[model samples]
Target: MDFLTITLPISGVAINPLLLVLLGVAVGVLGGFFGMGGAWMVTPALNIFGFPMPFAVGTDLCHMAGKSIISTRRHAKFGNVDVKLGLIMLSFDVVGIEIGARAVMLLERFGLAGLVIRWVYVVFLALIGSLIFYDFIKKRQMDKSGGDQSKSAITWHETLHKIKIPPMVNLPMAGVQCSLWLPATVGFMVGLLAGFLGIGGGLLMMPALVYLIGCPTYVAVGTDLFTIMLAGFYGAFTYGMKGRIELLAVVIMLAGAAPGAMIGTIATKYIRGYGIRLMFGATVVCAMVSVILKQMGQGGAASWVIMTAVTLMTAIVAIGMFKGAARELRERRLSHEPR
Candidate 1:
């Protein structure tokens, strides 16, 4: 293990090369599959493996820039990326992030930044996770009862669209015509939370896109990656300037992330929108649990818990991807068979 370890340039910490690779693979799969940076999962995992806590966000963001571009390009090939929506969201995110960062700075002056942020994180994660899980369960029950799930899923977005605020925008790619304020407001909120929490906003943005902006599941994933790519680059540059980023570590992680991203992007071709939502819900719940444990001051236990959840979620998604891909291949083969 000692010989397998290497020191990162900026962080100046020795870590196993293999662990970096594996972490990249895990987050890459999630990011590509779900259009998230997976920083929520990656941050704690890095801390557990002895990475400096302060440097974790910078390193993760640095890697996320590369990973998101790879994933976004792959998704674009599938016609799932909504470039217009992504750009719109990106602009608002910049504003929100600044506001949120400034707010955090103010809180720090009062000596309450850490505790306040942690509690808010716990609340946001728990609430959002529960809502997603509820939606998943509700859809399942509807399916069992032969009710219409699609109608139910879009009800919330539809209501928001009905607000009829001025400057409504038409998102042809996403198949939505609604107030521009909808996505702008959503992006700002996600950015604010991300800035305050010091993590990639993808985890928050995806749900908002799906439930608030009425983007198709696949489109939401791809567009989120588009936004994350730009944001990641900004985050990396700022953090790198502070000497918190390890370029070598980022390169090693990207080595594993590249392949994982390919697999994840390809998997989208076989999986349905609802299937993606369910998997995302599971991961959010995992994050929620980890936050709760952390708030309770179980630092050691929380790290392991996060690792377990991420490992399990990644493995399950990988299995699903392979199984779906295999089934598709078999179906194609059967269709091509002569009578």
Candidate 2:
């Protein structure tokens, strides 16, 4: 495929057709499995493949909207989504995004904005991803020993839920009756980062929902997908109104991701909490590796072989997840009494 040029009133931007499809395929898998678009994968891929930074950001926002629609519709069908939480999150996301955008502009004046924003994104990704990784690891160890933690340890959600603040609101999906600040704070923080980086911030939101708000893994996947649905539409509309979006590319990506998302979302049903967390953590780790390679490439130490390595690593991770879930299902089937 050839790179297509989309001209805005200000300037024309070039987008690689092959890279867009590649991004759609990878994000579709991650999004369907965990309800996160892995826009952390999209934005960087766009930038590296030769789109101007602004266009890359804008176009990914458009693409994310379509993907989120497919994902949200699928997840919502599973009886896991919380509409109230999604609406509450929507209220502050706009405010956080605007303030976050202004902050980025201020950083840009000093020529340090891009570096600072990316470093911040990586830190958040690592911190949130590490927390999920730790929980899954702890649970795996306990399973091996036939022991379980009795909810007495300091989990981020447990700590936050313990605070006796006023105006406790209930989130059925999160299964918490804590202060409004808890949910709003988590959403606002992630929203701010998303606005600044032109990302969907599902990685940030999903973990915060699980650990910060005590949402179950499956439910958090649903809630996160629902909220991303709103953000994506708003983002794409804003960009499209400004004539900065490539609608053609977005349409093609959507055509693939829609059905892929349906299958990905269904796969979660056969998977356990630990299995989902393992895969989710593994996805972030793979995204991290992808980022590392892109960084090395920037430093002139990368090769096309690195992309192949990334693809292989990602495939192995997905297969490992699917196999783990299959084994669990098979064992459960074996343990059941015949009807």
Candidate 3:
């Protein structure tokens, strides 16, 4: 058992040491590569194991903010980040997270905030999962037809560009001209979801940046992290000011994730971008399924039924991605070796 300090009136909390470190590592890897709010795993695991909702969310936000700051800087240094695109993304993403946060507060008044969040996860998860899955399946068809395709296709981005709305913004990095209203509306919608789910919304943000906002895959991810860094920092400060942040847990997780982030970043250099996207899509899809089953259990379904389903899915995915990344890394090294 590992224990970590919490805010006043709570003192400290105990958790499984190995699991905590593992959580940091898994989230670090995904966040480093995917620019997501891995709070899906952290908050749920924390809540299930006994941490209060607010504390779990608060601490995770702080950790995410810190890690994002580091990751965004690293990506920027590597020329993977587009500051102008990131700045543009920040406007909408921040508005979305803040609006999302406010919605969470409103849902709290109704009770069933957890259940509502689960449903939100189900909807967003299903929608994004379908979209990602379709992309790969479409890739196969395109390949079979002998059509050359870019590494990351932008059919959706092009479709969006055709909409001739007034006051369109030319996002050169994204290579799309979208209406100002488009970003604001998307941001507000995402923000409402974030508030309701009490999440950083990275899982949704990255995909949105790519498909909806029309940024290149690498640029979208880097920009998403830059945007999420803002959300996390703001969320953390707000929670801390309200006396909800858990310093001890944040300290412990960061201690583990700092090294893990270094490893994740190094691994990123070796791993193919497509590989990362597939795994990122798979992870969130699994998480989405998990949240769905959790909702099923809440609706009086057999707890084990939902538990078994989610557990199997999560385990298979997490392990598969880990092994796949390791194998890819090995293959990349071999290819670079002196013949």
Candidate 4:
């Protein structure tokens, strides 16, 4: 392993460069496809691979800043990004992050930070993953019965939008008209969770945008990336100032993440919105399992579980993307044939 190891300058720790690149690639796919930074996946994976918790969180955020830019550019080409919504959410999210960070600091003073954060992940991952999966099942059943599954009838989003409040705003791109406070509130809460957990916030924001703010799944993904870019920058700067960042490791990850994001973003054009939702739900469920394993003190087992699950999920998403693209190309060729 000596031949494969590289010493990180800031942290002065030896690590495998190959492992960093692979982690970046897997996370890049998840981020690009789901419009998330995948901190939930990356942080634990990093910890398993020898990064201290602070270093893992900091380096992940640093790479995410660049990875998100690549993915967001591709998503913008498809007109999937809602810039206004993203900006609004970013503003509220930043404030939430500060508050959440302070709260975590307070908990750390009492020696309860680790236990609290772990349980939070358990609760959040379980609740959100189950809801998304259930919705996927419901939609499938509705499709079989020839029932309508439009925005107006899709769970709590419709009900939330119906709330009569001051300062109503319309997001034509997201195809919703609701109070501006709606997104702000949701963004703040999600940001709080992200900051407290030292994550990128995408795991929570994707579902929030789709279910609470009533954005289309595709739009939710794109917008989430835009906001996550800002969050990453903030996280990177804060963690760097605290001397917790390993810049060299982050650079290695970015090398793979740049191209991986492009691949994942392009896949969006081939797959349907429902397909993205299903993948998102499945990945979250996997993350939940990984977090549970780690909480049990089975460090080696947890590491293997996360790496295996992430690799498998990324491969599945990649395959779905390729298959969908191939089918589209075939249809196009057929339509162009002499007839």
Q: Against the unseen true structure, what C-alpha lDDT does each candidate score?
A: 0.86, 0.70, 0.68, 0.85
Query: What TM-score would you give candidate 4 relative to the actual structure?
Result: 0.91
Poorest 10 consecutive residues by lDDT, candidate 3? 299-308
Highest-scoring model, lDDT: 1
Task: Enumerate residue pairs that collide in model 2.
Answer: none
Residue pairs clashing, model 1: none
- List model 2 lDDT by residue over 68-136, tens digit each: 777777777786788888777768777778888999999999999867876776676677668777887
RMSD of each: 1.8, 4.6, 4.5, 2.2
Residue-level lDDT tens digits of model 3 in 1-339: 225423333536656556556667666666777777578667766666567888888888888888887778777765667666556556766666676777777778998677777786788878888888777777768877887866455476666667777887766655656777666666666666665676677777777777776776776777777888887888899989988777766776777666656555555565556556676677667667666666666432333443344344434434555676788889999999999
Candidate 4 per-residue lDDT over residues 1-339, each given as its tens digit? 679888888787788898888888888887899999888778777777778998988888888998998899888888888998999888988889889999999999999999999999889999999888888888888888888766323578777878768898888789878888888888899889988986778889999999899888889999999988887898899998998888888889999898788768878877788888888888888778877887998777877777787888789878877887889899999999999
Worst 10 residues of 4 by lDDT: 149-158
Each prediction's TM-score versus the true structure = 0.94, 0.80, 0.78, 0.91
Q: Spell out the clash pairs found in candidate 3.
A: 96-191, 100-191, 100-192, 100-195, 101-195
Best by TM-score: 1
Task: List, in order, the clash count of every candidate structure.
Answer: 0, 0, 5, 0
Whole-model lDDT for model 4 versus the true structure? 0.85
Ranking by lDDT: 1, 4, 2, 3
| Ranking 3 against 4 by TM-score, winner | 4
